[model samples]
Target: MNTSEYGKVAAHTLKLRVEGMDCGACALKIESALKRLPGVSDINVNFGTEMLALNHDAGRTSRQVIEDKIRNLGYTPRPAAAEIAIPIDTGRQEDRPWWQTRKSRLVLITAALLAVAFGVAWVAPSLSFYAYVAAALVGLVPIARRALAGAMSGTPFSIETLMSVAAAGAITIGAAEEAAVVIFLFAVGELLENVAAGRARAGIKALIGLVPRVAQIEQDGEIRQVPVEQLRVGDVAVVRPGDRVPSDGEIIEGLSELDEAPVTGESVPLSKTVGALVYAGSINGNGTLRISITKTAADNTIARIIHLVENAQASKAPTARFIDNFAAYYTPASMAAAVLIIVVPPLIFGADWETWIYRGLATLLIACPCALVISTPAAIASGLAAGARRVLLVKGGAALETLGKITAVAFDKTGTLTVGKPEVTDVAAIEGDEDDMLAKAAAVEQGSSHPLGLAIIAAARSRGLAIPQTFGGASAVPGKAVVARLRDGFVSVGSPRHASELNLLPDTLSDQVQKLEGEGKTVVIVATKDLALGLLALRDEPRPDAAAGIRDLKALGLQTIMLTGDNRRTGQAIANVLGLDVRAELLPDAKLDAIAQLKAHGPVAMVGDGINDAPALAASSVGIAMGGGTDVALETADAALLSNRVGGVAELVVLARATLSNIRQNIVIALGLKAIFLMTTLLGISSLWMAILADTGATVLVTANALRLLRVRPTTAASPGESA
Candidate 1:
């Protein structure tokens, strides 16, 4: 059945049949297809169901064209079950004159008139006056309409339209040629603003385009290519080399290296074997694997990212909200003021209309606030793109703004500051070499999925030590130890307390365990023949950059704190290295409360792994989750470190502050320049050319300055060995 069967508004629906998708990437590709279309306002796609839903503007773009785009992206096009018009505020271009329909067109016409006026002045100096007046009129059309409408709408006054009116008033009095120059310049400024805004949205569009389409499903014991959405939970799917994982699921069979860089910002490929959980959007390297779906297409990692970013863009920041309202009213007030400057002065002071009118035209040229309107949004967009490039995904301008003001940074101990997985840092043997002990440990723990056990096996493999055959009668005791047969004797391995409980405690092993524990490492004792032989100490070490990064935060005047589930000694060890002021331990809920306590001091930002730390991340003024940690953390945190590096926190803070500072500077320059010119025009001392210079010049300056962020590279490196 078609999407119309679902009773949605068909006019707003875009049905896209896509191709070349072998996983959840297809859903993302479809969503982007519809979203980028002219009239399509919103879109959602289900990879497992092979379906898409969209809300569109039926007038400006067609569902057919959108569907065609989906087909172009290599997907089969099918109508959705329903289509509906969403309440999106898209006003008609007809409200303003045709000339102002787009900034580019306005700029072109303004340029043409300026050229004509200059040519006239060059060829016949006498009629240059009329040529100038004509040029000013060309520029005035857009400014006059905008200002008048804003005034009638009773909106807050904007500086651009006001400047435009002032310049135009000056030209009308007796300097018509000069008035034209001012209007043309203002139009040029508006054009530049439009260009910068367009560039800002580019990176976001590129990100949305990363989702792939289609999946190769294994159904009825036969491998066949089918729509990703058609693969339900428990359905098995085959993932080939270089293919993106279709859904969040567990590997049922086979082994492969998965590149999770796109989704998690980690450049390393993770080894996935049977029973290992894999996330969607991660690239499957060489080797094929059969996976059993665990999460639906909509609930997958990439889908959550799309949903979060899209909604974030829709939400306006305080700065944008203020400007929007201010522009609405400011335009018309400026227009009215320009008119008064011309007529009121003549009537009240008994001066000639020609002279006063010229003054009014000058005022009009200085009134348009295009530069001011475009300044902050463009900067915000650039900043967001910069963050994205570094594998950091900041929700929107609001989040970035909050990031700049964060005074205290709270970190979750596990995953955020330390690797979530345990690793063997020290291995010792009482009566044998290290390799022999590790080989036995690996063989015994090979089948176990416990974090500590995995660490032992991984360490042995890294050292190229071959593990012995699987041990018989293997038994795992909860929170205690694992006992199994070894070549020499029965071997038991677990925490020191557990070894003592089993009467396998040894004197040398106890001394080593205490020594390691004093170094803040977790110790597991290995006992043989009812006697502990050695101690294996493992600790999730602090990220190499964590210490220096914390120091950087302090340099920026931000306080740093560390919170973890580790014991006080372990927590304090990490805290001391990083110079954190607060170190809390032993409970997840306590982390959340600690975040609250930090907030009492000032605005606090909680840096964490999105998974177990969601509560604390949610409680902070701003939440920054490490990329690759968890899907929930990515969604819950206001900002995500796609680089999955702790040092990004420091860079993010610095970048945010820079962006805010640049925007403020631009606003001051734009408004300050206009004010100076406005005063000159009222005294009949400002020429039309001067007004044009001020308006367009300010626009170029601000736009160029806003682009300064493009050069503001991330100060954090993706890897410890990489340069920042």
Candidate 2:
């Protein structure tokens, strides 16, 4: 549960799924109404997600009070639980017929009445005025009711209020037919906007629908279906071919190709054998497998992703916050200007009251800030969803906005640029054969879990060498060696430095160690108390896509550098391969200093495995954790790469910049259309219907433009002569 502290008082968070919010203005209206309550604070109403989250002092105000306030504001408030439930229909609501929904039904009814009024006018001209009046009144009733509700709930300048005023003013000036037409056009515009909004929300809805409602669990030696919520950690869940994995777990039985496109956005299906990890919401291919559940349904990967994206959408970007503040004052100011337009011309210039009043009504209709209010959040939500679809999880709009401004990227070496697992690369004989030396080393490190130890054991196994079966008394020396008794003598596997201290390293072997270390290989000595056996060389190689990922960042004109605790030779060797600069032998504090120095130039983004690089990640402008990293890393960083690809860093940048561009385009479209309509309304060149069209058309265009971000495919190419 999300909680907050209000001074010394603990405040409980309330998350509600708000329905009937037609535009961004409705979110603001609900927020305004809730803020007037006694103990509510930290109010956030996301129109894109239709979620209302707030903190309230439970001692002063209960959930019921907050919900009642939302109801009074003319919106239905339900607990957020309904939002996470898997819907029976995975398809989008917009796919259904437009007239099937309640909002669209109202629009259709208004249209039908308007057509009847027009038919009456053509057939009986004498009763045409009354017929038009009747049609206008029928539509005006609902709009006026909502307008009155908004005014009573603290939002006196809502879009509904403006529409109601415009419709009534037109009828007052004896233009009942035009009033009817304006009302009908407003309904049509709203219906179109609803469809567009539904389209924007379709991605999130699809994500919720990815997991099935029930999972097949094995109980008492019998397989039965159970609700996904009943799945517990360690329970065995059977997944057949073409079924979605019910929970995050490891495969304990069978092999199959799992399609993780819905969760991680990987295009290729991954082959999952025994002991392989699988996430919930992944579609299984032609195999039946039993998996040991590692995470509950509530804590599964899909649930976390959905939660993160919703919270991200709720967090406003810097631009969105600015626009919100601007709209707050802009609305009242526009209303005052409209009032002046209505009174000044008739009172001072002896102009016709009816004509001036008509112009004032048009101005009111044009003054709606719906398009401007939705501009930033709509693009941000789409950008987040798009990134999620690609497995680039940005935490919030601020982080997404900051990613675009990053001029330099700093990466931790181990587990980030490199594969993080060391492998035996070379073996040399100083006394006995190389195979004998490797087998002796493996005998000493048989039970060890160290990367270098595991590599030697694996190398010996791969070569089918026979390790001594009588080896015993194996013990580890911290940061140095693993010593064990083999056949009547003691054999040791340790670093070159440790061998030198024990006087067991031969001069030839010492020189060989230097050569291997210079090439970025870790040289370990395999020797006895009196004689040198041989040496084993191990190295953690760079990831396959490391070079290409670095090249992509350079192409985007950003500096790239590696910070590592490894020796200069090894760090530089990896850096040389990846085509990036290196800052070697840095302790944790030194890494922080390096990040600070990088930040002196511009905003620096730090990428790390998340556990050892927390300080640097926190110090940088935006920290991006590589996927499969520790939970601390994922939570500490502003964004995470669930795909675990180094190339995802470049893609994330491209997506952020694309989102910013989309936002700018939306703002221009929104304000530009409003400016044009505002001028035309004042000049008497635009009618009331056209003013409503301007508002509605701008909203639809902005929303549609924001949805284009969902289709963005980021590609990488390196330009010539770019460097860190």
Best by lDDT: 2
The local distance difference test score of model 1 is 0.69
Per-residue CA lDDT of candidate 1, range 1-724, in tens? 1235677444554544232221222343345445555656657553322335566766667766765565554345544322211111123222234345466576788889889889999999998888878787767776665555433333224333455555555554565655665566656655554454444444544554444557778767798887555557887888999888887789999999999877766678989899898887778999999999886666666666655554454444568557756754665677788889878867988988887776666666677665566556656756666666556678877888888888888888778788777889998888678888888877778788888889998999999998877556678877887878866777777888987777776676777778788778888887775566677889888887788788778878888888777778888866876778656564867777788888988889998877777787888999998855366556667998866788889888877887788778878887898898898878877777787666677777776776677567656423222111
| Cα lDDT tens digits for candidate 2, 1-724 | 3444654657887877776675777788888788888888999888777778888988899999888777776667766664333422323334466667657877888999999998999999998999999999998888888888788878898888999888888888988988898888878777877777777777777787888889999999999999998899999999999999998899999999999988766779989899999988999999999999998888788888777787888888999889999998998898999999999999999999999999998888889899999899889988998888777889999999999899999999999999899989899987868898889888898878787889999999999999885455598888888889988589888888888898888898888888888889888888887766888889998888899999999988999999999999999988887899999999989999999999999989999987778788889999999865235534769999877779989989988888998999999999999899989888889988888877888888898898898888775644221110
Model 1 lDDT at residue 320? 59
Worst 10 residues of 2 by lDDT: 715-724
Each prediction's RMSD over C-alphas, in Å, is: 9.3, 4.0
Cα TM-score of candidate 2: 0.90
Off by over 4 Å in 1: 1-172, 205-314, 323-357, 442-449, 461-472, 476-480, 486-488, 498-507, 577-579, 586-589, 682-684, 717-724
